[model samples]
Target: MQPTTRLKKPAGSRNEILTVGAGDRVYESTKLGAVFDMLINHGVPADVVLRDVNIPHQEVHSPQTRISLTQLMTICQNALRLSTDRHLAYRIGASVHVSTYGMFGYAILCCPDFRKAMDFAMRYHALAAPLATIEFSEDKADARWTIEPNLHAVAESALYRFVTEMQIGIHISLMRDIMGPTFTPSEIGLAYPQASDFGLPQDQIGCPVRFEQPANQIVFRSQWLDRSADLGNKTTYPTIVALCDDLLGDLKLRIGIAGKIRAVLLRDIANPPSFEAIAKLLDVNDRSLRRQLRQQGFSFRGLRDELRTQIALKYLRHTTLANEDIALALGFSDAANFRRAFHRWTNKAPSDIRGE
Candidate 1:
């Protein structure tokens, strides 16, 4: 048997107190679409799940449509409530094929090796699930993939568990498809506690599972990172990546002026360009840019602050950089000001986030 440990939930579940932002972020509809299709194919009445969640049946069919993360979670919650099986998430995840992801899937399939495929997946992950941010880190012995859901408001709910499980299951299934059936993670770390009658995730995931960890992650041997993908297509890899890029660009445009500005701000995080500079970059005058952003329910300052908060939290959680350096990287005047602003944004200190 693999090693396993469970920790007690922290006082008051700080995660529940943390805000998840405006909850306006969306994911590619294809993910939910694939799951719903599979549910229907399995003789399940998925329509009830959609109806209870207030999601139109037609919306799931369009790959171009983007669904908010909140709605997606609600749908999953409803599915779990209605389905008799405890492992509904695992089943849906296993049924999904890489081709279900459209261009994003193709890009991964065409990579020369697992490492390169992971690079492509990380770069274009938003194309599949914009509401979750993924990070990959590796040392001589192991590689870790950490998934941080942007839906903090639902962090303590069963919806969170279902979605997190489905995500892990999907990745496990995808990896197995690529590396062949024998591959498995070295271990799995989950933020949620184990269910009382939790199905056999260890057996399905092919690894020992740890619960209530600092983060949700999967660990695997580093040696496998260099393994060649069975479906690598060097001849079409470039074309597939280009096509994926186009899809990403189109998605950003669909998000409107606010999304475009957010993209620019992220790219220029070290020294965020001025409003006039960003307007010029977007080929619009300053006044027009402001007006367009306003129309899209965003202000330049608000967007910048949100972006900074996001980057700050990411740095605090994922990197060991000094708070002062993070402040500088975020273009704050100094560490003190960044701390004050961070508190105002999150109602918690930067140190607290890092400590977790």
Candidate 2:
């Protein structure tokens, strides 16, 4: 794992939905500002989109607030569905100016060179609160970032592609912010097939695009790494990182028992510990823990099952993992038992998901 890499999880409902309220799943992070603005510019109703995602109307309107993956994902779904633009992700993502990213963007702008900017991005990306994991590396010929969006159980999902494309657009836009507007990636590689004429509105971020790649990648020349940034400042860069570090501490602070348990569980989600184990780790008795969850409108079983169902569906939709393998990974007894429980939770056969 790279030093800068991190991933997050989801929650919702009656089956695939988390039993907890949307409030519990949220963290006090920045708003989905630009995405919503772009959606509205396209004539999509912001209220309708928020309603579809089951978020408060005020959440998106506020400059800073709590947001969860369910809220973000559903917002994208509604925005894409309601809008007429086919290349919505590319348009909005590319149009994003680094200044809109707040202090984090400003820090990158202050870096002495592209190399420092890349390193700064690796370490400080959490300040931006990205949903996808951005991995950076370099070979003799090329410097590359292989981006993997979370919730990619089905690589072909519109949600996945939209999120991924948006990331690509941000890279193009932000690199231009640091490296200059004339900078172009050596190439762009996508894990999924091309959707429509992907490069339409060709005046933006024009680069060679390859489809059906093993990973989503943005490749550029290693020579560019040494290129000096236009606004490199020794003073502002460290100050920005220090402020962002403080912000990160605040983000890492766990507020509720549910959130605390979620952090512990996700650490080793593939082989989850028992209720007793979680209880011991939290320095609480089982009865106390149970009471605390009930107060939050959730149960341990519901929380664990919600995470499992979410990941299982991701695997079913995104990967070709055998039923037995996914079951074992989730600590299920067997494929047969896994299938039965999945139906109970989702009211549909597991195969039914893959079929769709």
Candidate 3:
């Protein structure tokens, strides 16, 4: 028999995504068009896949349209429900290429090397319109990309798998686009257990896959970062990057004051900027920041607590970091404060939820 340990859920339950930027609706709609079209190709009626998604196929054609992550999650849910292909997320992702990303793709094409491309993508990933939140990191031997759907009130392992696989598929497709068709990640990690129902992702991923891992990550060699891109252009790269930066700025504006604040806070969540300092950095007066947050039915403290709660949970559930270290990561002065804060945010003791 398998051994099991006590695993207490987070505030909304462990299954909920509960990301930092909780209420942003900045995702591009065109991405979902692919999912919609895929369903259609699978003999699923257009209306059937879009039942409660409320997005019209025509609207996605517009370059300016944006949708919420919740909508994307709903579309994936619908797609999974009606389609028999359990690896539908990977299939949808595999179909994506540089051309699918619009200006974001162009910026990547202009990158001089794989390292530059990875940096460029990480810096402007919001433009790529991922179904989940992805963070990039590197160590001595490997470059890694971690995925988190981070959707508010979202649960269901199936939905998580769908979002995670689709994102990985997109990464693989884009890597192949720039690094030649031969490129593939060294390993893939899935947060969920390997169950028979979801189908085998390794078949489509073409890489070693590990399940019940700390995170959903795509890992590749650090040396591959030096590989030259087939389409890299030293001259045009800067110009394209400039345009991409402008596009990113515009997108951030659309993401709103709270969303922007969340992004800034995430940069240094362990020692987040003071609300006043953040206001000044964002070039908005404190009054305006407070008013905007109030209008959105949020307060800075509330947002901070929510972000801290999620980060705290991730640390406890994913890492074996001592409570004091996790406390430091959340900007708590000491472990006792972190303990109290954790109890306040989650209504459960930290030790109760820490993964075995």
Candidate 4:
């Protein structure tokens, strides 16, 4: 059997593999119209979704307002039927590039080394349009390019859309940015088999193309990872890398704060602390902490509740605690309160969560 590729699931138990900037995926002005249209057509209650985002039905049809990631996911959950199909998402993403940053983007991408350019793409892709993730993978002999979807309802389709368009645009731009649009990949692969008009552009460069692969990806010789032309755009690539490293660190804390907070809670389980106390320990103010969690696409209450629920379930399942004992252990006031809270957390009773 092929070695199983296991990825860490999100707190929501999502099986997605790509780490994406949730904020960046939303908030792109250019993508507002197409996404809105798709959502409305897909059976979401337009008014309800609009209310969730404070956008009116008319404004969604208008060209002025942008959509947020949260709004889009809510719509996808309620509307899009094939949101899980990764390929469809990629196809949608390919069309979004037109409204995104135009030629300057091409110039920046083509000028940088492969690694630096990839980092820039990941970091700023949200700024241009929040579609999918572009990441690099390397082994001893070859480098692979892959696309990952963000946490939208249409996770798979989104991944497909990102990989397809990104491969097409970046490949063409790579050569154009260097040698006036004449450069071409000696060999190319497309995960989706259907032909696109884009293949015609390869005629200009006389390169071989392959389609229908295991994943929407490209493989290239490692030697090509570096370029010699040295068109040197004056932006320091190393500085960009350093900046990406710093931002990634911040993102880790943001996304994984629940786990970090869980650790602290574990340490203080005997004497559960207040939110203010936890915020002070983490070196953030209460409001700032709440805002950061919101921006990072989560809530402090959600995290705390999840942690407490986990502890309650653990105690119920593994230990011989009565419901009242489990309640006390998890800092709840009493057995009744614990049962109500656990029901809220799992949509099942505490006993059900414990399989009792």
Candidate 5:
């Protein structure tokens, strides 16, 4: 069946609704900063986009910083508003280089062949784009690289199209950089519907663009998998991969004691660990852990409450669990207590948050 194009509500209409809260997905500032730079290159005022999104202009300059996904979406929405170019994503993506991704990109560039690069990307995608999931599958005739948002119920948002387009364009640009300028996907599939006004993607992607498909994917012949990448570097490959590994490991550690506590809680929310237990798990004594947490501006009870609130929102938005069951899962003594806590956390009833 031919896919129908889905137009999104105007950016202004959805801005407030899409604002992210705690526990929402985030992207590395380096990636978003690159997009911001591109917007400036296109003459979009930096102050205007930053002020609209409530992001400090200096924050994007730091590669180690992260920004919420909603903030990234808002910036894109503002970019579209301030610029006449509908192909902003593609344009920005086309300019991307292997270095833009830091060690992750270099790891790919160092792979001996396209197949090995694909394997590396599939294995370490989290290091590059934690907010999106990339899956690789193959049949007898063709290979597919499917991309989708990692978050639940995000594909319907207007930002999905822009992000998907930018990502697909980056893939195409990377492939051309590695395999040679002649390379192209056999076909491109997008979750969003086609728009006649957006004609440049078809030309830029150098393939037939199909919209409203089963998922966002790039299809190509399986044989291309074995094609040797021109930039493969045997000497530097292992070094770069090891560097990426260290970066990924550091990413976990950088999340801080509060983040570590949240992770522990999320892992076993029904029976969250006591502060003493959590400190032991983190390899520190309770007293030391408490001091460290205090230094980081976090308290154990506050962290637990925040985690519960985030989990409650996740359950309310993504599942049909009853209030009693949700309460039980969250270790509440009763539904009434859970309801009151939910209201206190969000200033809205559980049912109201659940839209029931």
Candidate 6:
């Protein structure tokens, strides 16, 4: 029998919508930064993100604070073209290829087991780059890997193309950290057409590289996935998880009730519903709504700004909406406010965004 498209899982109680949380999975390193970088690159201004978190723009790089899972998921859903964040999680994987860790490089060195290790990196890849994606599969005797993103045209520009190269480079480098430097892959594939664009293959990945392939993937012996390492790295897993916990907490720190409010705002924003109107929809008092948002890491004002930021970018990049029209659609007072906000988020004026 084939895998069913929909499988029912246990819901906690009647009328309760169950959702998957981050602790349920693992994420790859640097991929989280890569995803955050993609959101900035696409349109969500760093200042706005900082403001949403109640941090100054200059402090965004502070290692002390982290963003919340709710915020990350909210933004990812708004900004990404994919159907689900689970599909986006694959960006955390890098090709281990011929490294000393063998096929178990990521699993043995840093992960408790192959499955947990794979899932760990995948779960947090958003902190790295929003556009990165990795897919894993088993076919016959080989484990297959696929890494690529449906990057928007702006993200496909020369700068981001170079960024993609660096992303791939970091992936291999991290693998080398766990595995010996002598590692090589049986076969390597890339979606990019120009090998030169990625620089000399010998220098970049230190292995044979193939370009102009139908997809990007690496095939290796499946047995490697099950092999246990001589040493256990339980200590490493906690440290990584702790870091992720902190990052998620930073976003949660601000606007504690933002999550619940954001949900209602998303539904009524198109129709310009009043706060009292939205509160009635939730069957709660305004005070109750505000308090709930405080728990969710955002406020009504902040979520409204973020929602507008996401909507503006999608319209500008994916649609042919005029600036004036987009401004109106986003409920901005006018095109000027939209232009200013767009500039703040992207560091680029609307004309440049429109390629005018």
For all predictions, the C-alpha RMSD in Å is: 16.6, 18.1, 17.9, 16.7, 17.1, 18.2
Models 1 onward score TM values of: 0.63, 0.64, 0.65, 0.40, 0.63, 0.42
| Candidate 6 lowest-lDDT run of ten | 2-11
lDDT of 5 by residue, 4-91 (tens): 1111111232221111232333346655676789878877678986755666787776764676555665676676667667787777
Instruction: Write candidate 3's Cα lDDT for 286-338 as tens digits.
Output: 99999987755468998888778878888899988999999888888999999
Better candidate number, 1 or 5, judged by TM-score? 1
Report the C-alpha displacement of residue 165, candidate 6, in angstroms.
2.0
Give model 4's clash tally. Answer: 12
Instruction: Report how far off residue 7 is in candidate 4 (Å).
Output: 12
Which candidate number has the best lDDT? 3
Model 2, 98-127: lDDT tens digits are: 787777788888887788788778665655
Top TM-score prediction, candidate number: 3
**Candidate 1 lDDT tens digits, 89-182:** 7677776668778787877888988988776776667666533566778889999889765444255566667667777777787777777788
lDDT (Cα atoms) of all candidates against the true structure: 0.71, 0.71, 0.76, 0.52, 0.71, 0.49
lDDT of 4 by residue, 48-92 (tens): 545455567777655345555555554433333433323333233
lDDT, residue 109, candidate 5: 88
Deviation from native of the Cα of residue 338 in model 4, angstroms = 43
Segments of candidate 6 deviating more than 4 angstroms: 1-61, 64-110, 153-160, 195-200, 223-227, 234-356
Pairs in clash, predicted candidate 2: 12-17, 12-18, 13-17, 13-18, 153-314, 153-317, 153-318, 154-317, 154-318
